[model samples]
Target: MTADREITRRHAGLLDRLKRPELDVDETDDEDLRHLELRRVVLEVAELDHAQEIALVRAAVARFGKAGQA
Candidate 1:
């Protein structure tokens, strides 16, 4: 019917848009890796303290043991 043709046309348009070749240096594209900004803000983690780190390591060992059992 006419509705089916309209749906097919819409789907085709979407497919064409997806198939279109992307620009090598696409600044507007979000996936463009060329202009990626990396920020560093180093903050000390309290959980990484000596005693807490030992506790974390023990917990990880327990979790791994349980995982191996399964």
Candidate 2:
């Protein structure tokens, strides 16, 4: 398969996994859970337009930046 096709396939798989409500938390380790959560976030961000993406980044920074500075 072409690289683009492979990437699209992988993305589809990730989206399917994210949508499943039957996922057992006990079946995955903490790191796997974090990775899945991160994938979900990235997929959500990908749906936003440029302006919305910027707004999300700004909001995230406002919400979490202070904690990092401490």
- Cα error, residue 65 of model 2, in Å, equals 3.7
TM-scores, all candidates, are 0.31, 0.27
Badly placed stretches (over 4 Å) of model 1 are: 1-47
* Candidate 1 RMSD to the real structure: 13.5
Q: lDDT per residue, candidate 2, 1-70, as tens digits?
A: 6999999999998898775576566655866667677666775657777888799999988879688788
lDDT of 1 by residue, 36-67 (tens): 53322122323346787799889998798689
Which lDDT value does model 2 have at 35?
62
Candidate 1 global CA lDDT score: 0.67
Candidate 2, residue 34: the lDDT equals 75
Misplaced by over 4 Å in model 2 are 1-47
